[model samples]
Target chain A: MSAPRAEAVVIGASAGALEALSAILPALPARFPLPVMVVVHIPPDRRSLLAELFQAKCRVIVMEAEDKEPISPGTVYFAPADYHLLIEHDRTLSLSSDEPVLFSRPSIDVLFESAADAYGDALVAIVLTGANDDGAKGMRAVVEAGGRALVQTPESAFASAMPRAAIDLCPVARVMPLAAIAAYLLEV
Target chain B: MNGDPGSEKVEDIEIRLLLEAIYSQYHYDFRSYAMASIKRRLRQAREHLGFPTFSAMQESLLRDPALLPRLLGYLTVQVSEMFRDPSYFRALREKVVPHLRTYPSLKVWVAGCSTGEELYSLAILFREEGLEERTIFYATDINQDALHAAEAGIFGVDRIPLFTENHRKSGGKSSLSDYYQAAYGRVAFDKTLRRNVVFSDHSLVTDAVFGEMQLISCRNVMIYFDRALQDRALGLFRDSLARKGFLGLGAKESLRFSKHADAFADFVREERIYQRRFE
Candidate 1:
C-alpha cells in the first residue's frame, strides 16, 4: 500500500508497552508536527507512570490527556490510567468514565475508533506489542475510515496477539519491525 | 460523494438532530455535551436499541414518551464505585475534614451522584469523621433512574471487594462489612447511611444552585461536557460554595483555564481539590 498522508497518530500497546513504546516515541524529533495520542492498558487502581517515564526520554511534550484541552499540534498525549481518551471533531480531547471496553478502561479500541472519526483519512493508527486483541476492532475502524494502519510485525513484538489481530483484521495494513516503525513515523 | 469520504459528516448532522429532538421533546439539554462521547454512546444505543439510524431513533423519540428514559440510559453515564479514587478520599480525610468539622452544620452536595456510590462513600466518610449526624447530604442527578438506584443503596456483591479495598486505602476507620449486608449476590448498605441524605432531580447544566454547600464533590461528571458546559458547572459550584468551602473534582479534571479559575484556590492540587476563594 502507498504511504498515506498523516495529520495525527494514535498508538495502542499493552503488556509489553514500555519496551515497545520506548523504541518508537523517543525517536520523534522535538515539536513534531502531528499530535500523538497513546493508550497503554494499565490497571485502574495504580497511577500511570508512562507519561512521566516517557517525558524523560522524549524531546516532545508528554502529559496525561485532560478533558476539553485543545489538541496541540506537537505534543504527545497519554491516556490516563482509568479514562478512555477520545478526540472530538473539533480537535479537543475528551475523557470518558463510561463502561470499559473488554474490561480495559483505557481501551485501545476506544481511542483508535474515536481518533479515526476525528481525523478520518489523515490519521495514522499503530498497533504495537500487546497480549490481547483489543486494538484489532479499532484497526478495522481506522482502515475502513481510510486512515493508515501500521502493525508492528507480529514475530518482532514481545507478545504478538495484538498486532497479529490488527494484521488479520486489516490485511492492507503495513507490517514493520520496531526500528522501521519509528522510521516510518519520523517520515510522516 | 457529497459528504466526507466516510459519510462521517452526515452522521454528525444526524446526531445533532437527535440531540435537538431529545431536548425539544424531553427538556434534557445534552445538545452542548462533548460530541465524541455522545456520538459513541448514541452509536451504541442505535445498535443495541434496534434503530438503523439516529434519524430513525429521533423519529421514535419524538412520538414515544416511554422511549425517553430508555434513551437517557444511553445519554448519561452511570458507572462508578464507592471510594473509586483512594487518594482523593485520603486527602479529604487528612486535609479537608478538619476545615469541614469547623462548620457547625454542614451541607455536602454530591453533584451528579450517579448510582449512589459516591454519595454512600461520603455518607460513610462523614459518619466515621463524626460529622454525619450534623451533615445534610444532597445527592442529585438529572436521571431519575440513577437517583432512585442511589436511593435504594444496593450494589453488586462482586463490587464490594473493590469498594472495601478502596475504603481501606482511603483511611477508612471501620470495617466495610459493618456498613452493608450481603445477600443473594447484592449488598444493601445500612439504611441509616441515607438518614441525613436528600435525593433530588437536578441538572448541573440547567438547574440553578439550590443550597450553599460546605463541600462539593463532583467527580468524573464534568468530563462529559464541552468546555462551555464545564464552565457553567464550575460557575455553579463557585456560586454555591460558602466562602472557603471545598470543591473536589475527578482526578483528571482541573480548574485551570476554566472561566471560574479565580473563584477557586487550590487546596489539594494533586488530588484536584480546590477551595472556594473568599472574595
Candidate 2:
C-alpha cells in the first residue's frame, strides 16, 4: 500500500512560538511545493509583524493571509492578529471576527478544524510549543479527517502544555523534536 | 443537540434549511454569508434561544415575528470600537483627507456603520479639519437596533479611555472630550456633531445605492460575505462613488481578488484605502 501524500500544511503555536518557528521556517527551501498556513496567538489590539519578520529570514515567501485571497504554493500565510483564519472549499482564505474561541481570536482549533474540512486527507497539521491547550481538539479533528498529525515532543518544547494536550487527544500523532521536525517536513 | 458521531453532517443540513427559511420569511439575505462563522453563530443562537435543534429554532423563528430581532441580534452584532485600527484612521486623516479637501461639498457614506463608532470618528475628524459645515454623512446598517443606537450616539463611559487614545493617535486637533457629555455611566455625544448626518436602514446585500459619495468607508463588513456577495457589494460601491472617489476597507479586507479590482487604484496600499479610477 502507498502512503498518502500531503497537499498543504497547517501549523499552530502560542507562547514561545517565535523561537520554534525560526527553527522550522528558515530551513525550508524556496522551492517547497505546498502552501503553509499558520496561527500564532497574538494580542487582539496590536498589528502583527509575524509575516515580515519571517519573510526576512525564511527562503520561502511569507505574508499575512487576506480575506478571500487564493492560496499560493511556495508561500507561507500567517493568520491576522484579530481574526480567525478559515480555508474555503475552493481553497481560498477567509477571515472572521465573530467572537473569540477559547479566549483567542485567531484560535488554533478554528483554523485546524476548518483546514481539515477543506483539505481532508491531503492535509498535514502540526502542533508546536504553547502554554495553552488550544490545538489539542484541532489535532484530533485533523487525525479524524484522515489527515496526518505531528506534535513537537513535550520534553523539547519551551512550553510543553500544548504538545502534551495534543498528545493526550491524538496519542498516535508522530512526535518529533524541534530539530527533527524540519527534516521530517523536508522529507514529506 | 446530542453529540453523535455524524451529527456534524446533520447539523450542516439543518443550518442551511434554517438560513433558507430566514431568507424566505424575513427578506434579510444571509444565505450567502461565509458558512463557517454562520454555522458557529447559528449554533450559539440554537443554544441560547433554548432550542433542541436548528429545526426547532427555525420553526420558532417562522412562527413568532418577535423572534426575528433576537435572531438578527445574534447574526449581526459584532464587537467594534471607536477608531478600532488607529493606523487606518491616521492614514485617512494624513493621506486621504488632503484629496477629500479638494471637493467643495462632500458626501461620505459609512456603510454597516454598526453603533456609529466609525461615523462619529469621521464626524469629529471632519469637524476638526474645519470641513464639517460642507459635509453630509450617511450612516447606514441592516440592524435596526444598531441603527437606532447609532442615531442616539450614546456609548458606555468605560469605552472613553480607549476612544480618547485612538482619537489622539489619529491626529485629533481637538480634545475627544469636547464632543460628548457624560451622565449616569454613559456619554451622549453632542447632538450637533450629527446635525448634518443621516442614520438609515441599509443592507449591502440587498440595498441599492441612494446617492453618489465622495468617500465610502465600509470596513470589516464584507469579511462575512462570500465571493459573489462581496463582488456585488463592491459593484455597488464602484457605482456609488463619484469619479476619483475613495473606498476604505478593513485591514484584513482587500480588492485584489474582487472582479471590481480594475476600477480602483491603490491609494494607501498598507492601509487598504483605494481610489476610484478616472476611466
Candidate 3:
C-alpha cells in the first residue's frame, strides 16, 4: 500500500545509458540519504570516465567502486570497467574478474542480485535504457528479496529493450519517464 | 538474541560448513574470504561438478582427498595475462628500474604469479634493463596447475599480439618476438628468460616470507581477499621487502586502509607502487 523504505539504490544501464544517467543523477540533491551503486556496460579494455564525468554534474559524491571498500551515504559508486561489482554481507564493496555473465563483465544482474542479498527489503533497484536484457533477472531478484523495482517506461527510453525486459520479467513498482523516476528517487 | 533466524538461510549455513570442512580437512583456509564471491564460485563449482548442493560437494570433499585440487581450481581465480595493465609495467620500467639499477644484485618476487605471465614480463624487463644477469626471480602461486603452466612458459599464440603491443607500450627495449618462438599455435618463451627464476607453490593466505627482495609485483591478487587476509599478505610483503624496496599492486588495491600501511610509502601513487620505508 505504501512505498518501501530504501537504504540503498542499485541502477543498471547499457546503450544510451550515459545520457539517461546524466539526466537523472543531477536531480538528487546533495542531502540524498541512500548510497547508490551503478553498473553501466563499458568497454572492458579501456578505463572508465563515468565517475569523473558524473561527479562534475551530480551534487553527491561519485567514484568508481573499489574492492573491500565500505559503502557510504551520499556517494555514488560505479562498477569498474572489467570487474563484476558485488556487495558483501558486511556492506562493503568488492570487485571480481570472474567470467562474464550475459556477455558482460560488470553485469547488471550480478550487482542487482548481490545488492538484493545484502540489503533485502531496504534496497531499491532501477532498470534504465539499454540494448540488452542484462537487468531482467536482477530486477526479478530484487522483487523476490522484498525490495522495490522501478523500470523506465520502454517507450520513453532511447534504447527500450532493457526496460521492456525488466517489465516482462517482474511486476515492477513503477514505469515512468526519466524525470519522474528521478523525482521518485528524490522522494526516497 | 544472538542469532537472527530469518537472515540465515539453509544455503548460507551449508556454505559456511563447507568452507569449514575445507579448512579443517585440507588446511586451505577460505573461511575468511568475502562471502558474496565465495558464494558465487561455490555455486559454479556445484553446477559444474554435478553436485546437487554445497552440502553434497562438502560431503564428497571430506571423504575424497583427490578432490581438493579440482575444488581449489574453482576457489582460486586464474585470470591474468602477459603485461596486463601495461601502464603499471611502464611505470616500473621508467620509474622503478632506475632505483633497482643501483643495486648490485636484486631479488624480485612475483607473488601470486598466475601462469608466470607476470614473472616472464618482469624477467624480460630485467633483461632489457641489463639487470637480469644480476637478479633472481621467485614466482609463486597457490595453484599447482598454474605453477606447472608457469614453468612450461607457453601460452596460446593468439595472445601474442596483444602481449607484444603491451610490451611495446611498457617501453620494451627489444621486440617481444625476440623472447619467444611460435610453434603449434602456441608460443614457447625462451628458457633463458627464466634462467634466474624459481617457480614455487605458495599461498598468500597461509604462506610465510621466504626471502628478502628488492621488489615485489603482486598485482590483482589481493582483490579476492578480505580485509584481514589482505593485511596478512601485506604484512608478509612488508617483512620480506628490503628497506626502500618497491611493492606493486593491482590498480584497484591500495595500502591507505591496510593495517601495514605505515610500513610503506607511496612510490608511484598513480600506478599503485609503494616503497618500504624504514623507521
Candidate 4:
C-alpha cells in the first residue's frame, strides 16, 4: 500500500532557491490536498516578499504564518525571513529567535527536522539548490522518521552543494529536476 | 577523536554527559535540546566560566547554586527586542485593544516572556490604550533569572532608541521615552505601568493553565520545544483562553497545521493576531 496520506510538503532551500521555487510552486494544482511549507535561507534584518511573490504564481492561498494560526490544506506557508519556522504537533507554527544554525536562522535543517518530528511518515521533505549542506542531517532525520525525502538533481540546481550533500548523507527516495518536483508531488 | 575537525563524536559525548549531569544534579531538563544549539551554548558557557573541560563546567554548576544563573544565561536564548515586529503591536493597538476595552477588566498572559522586554512593551501598550487601569498582566518564564529581571523592570539604555522607534511605528500615542526613566546608562520602566503585572515561573511544556484569560501572548517561546511540547503548550493556551479570547504569537508562528488550527481564526494574518473561534 502507498504510505500514509501526505499531510504537508516541506521544502528546504538556500542560495539560488527562489529560481527553483518559481518553477515548483505553479506545478502543484490549486486543489492540491496538502499544505506546503517553504524554508528559504534569508538574510537577517530583511523583510521577505516570498508569500506575496509566490501567491501570484501558485493557485493556493499563500500567506505568512501568524503565530497560533492553524495549518490548512490548499494553502502555502513560507518561512518568515530570519526566523526558524517550526510545526507544533497540533500543526501550528512556532518561530524561534534562537541563534542561527549553520549560520542561517530560517534554516532548512530546523524546518526539515521539525516537520519530520511533527508529521513523520506523512511528510515529504525536499532539498533544493543551495550553497551549504544545511539540509543533510535534517533530511537524514526525515528518512529515519519514515518520511519521504527528495533532492533536486545537482545539474538542475544553480547551487548543487545542498542537494549533493543530502544525497551523500542519506538514501533519498527521489532526485528530480525542479520542473519535475511538483509533478512528482502530484503523482505521489 | 583528536584532531578530527568534523567528527562530533567526542563533542557530542561531552555535551550528552554534561546535559545528563545537569539534569541528574539540578533537575533542569535541557537534555532534549537540539545537539547543535546545545553544543554551541555549552561551549560559550565553558569559555565564559573559564573552565577547560566540560567536566569542570559541570563541577562548577553542581558546586555553586549561584552558577546556575550564569549557566542559565548560556542555555536560554535571550534575543528579544521591544515591540519586536512593530506592526504586530500596531494591530494589537488598533484591532484587539478596542475589544479589550469593552470589558470592565482584563487578564492577559505573556507566556515564555524572556527578559521582560516584551512584558514591559505590552504594559506600555495597555497604558497607552487606557486599558492599564483595569488590566492584570501575568508575565511568565521558565528561567528564574529572567523572571527576576522582568520583575525588576530594568533594561539597557542602548536599546531605548530602537524600542522607541518600534513603539512609534506601532502607532504609539505618546513619547515612548515617557514609559521609562533613563539614568546613568540604564532605564527603569515606570512603576505604574507594571503596577498590575505579575512575573512568575511557568513552564508551558509541563504546566497546566493557571487561569482563564481574555488575551494571551506567547511569543517566540515555542520555537525551542519539539512538536509534542508545542502541541501541549497550544492545548494549554487553548484551554486557558476564555471564549472569544485573543491569542498572539511571534511573526513566524502559526496554527495552520496544528490539531487546534480550527480553534482560532485570524484577525490579522500578517501580524499574527487571532481570535478564538466560537465553539
Per-candidate clashes come to 0, 0, 0, 15
Query: Candidate 3 on B1-279: residue-level lDDT in tens?
Result: 118877687888899899999999988889878778888888888999999988999999999989889988888857677888899999999999999999999999999898888999999989999999999999998888889989999999999988999898888999999999999999999999989999998888888896789999998788888899999999999999998999999888888768899999999998899999986
The better candidate by lDDT, 1 or 3, is 1
DockQ computed for model 1 against the true two-chain complex using alpha carbons:
0.85
**Which digits, one per residue and each the tens of the lDDT, describe model 4 over residues A48-92?**
888998888888889876544568998889888867777755676
Ranked candidates, highest DockQ first: 1, 3, 2, 4
Docking class of 1: high
Which fraction of the native contacts appears in each prediction?
0.84, 0.62, 0.65, 0.41
Q: After superposition, how far is residue A25 of candidate 3 from its true place, in Å?
A: 0.8
Model 2 bad stretches (over 4 Å): A1-3, B1-9
Deviation of model 3 at B183, angstroms: 2.2
Superior candidate under lDDT, 1 versus 4 = 1
Error of 3 at B40 (Å): 1.1
- Evaluate every candidate with DockQ and list the scores: 0.85, 0.65, 0.74, 0.21
For candidate 2, write residues A36-128 as lDDT tens digits.
999999998888999999999999999999999889888999999989998876788889986788899899998998888778888889999
**Highest lDDT: which candidate?**
1
Model 1 scores a C-alpha lDDT of: 0.92
- For model 4 the local lDDT of residue A124 reads 91
Model 2, span B136-250: residue lDDT tens: 9999999999989999999999999999998999888989999999999999999999999999988899999757799999989999999999999999999999999999999
Q: Could you tell me the lDDT of residue B77 within candidate 4?
A: 45
Q: How high a TM-score does candidate 2 get?
A: 0.92
TM-score of chain B of 1: 0.97
* Native contacts recovered by model 1: 0.84
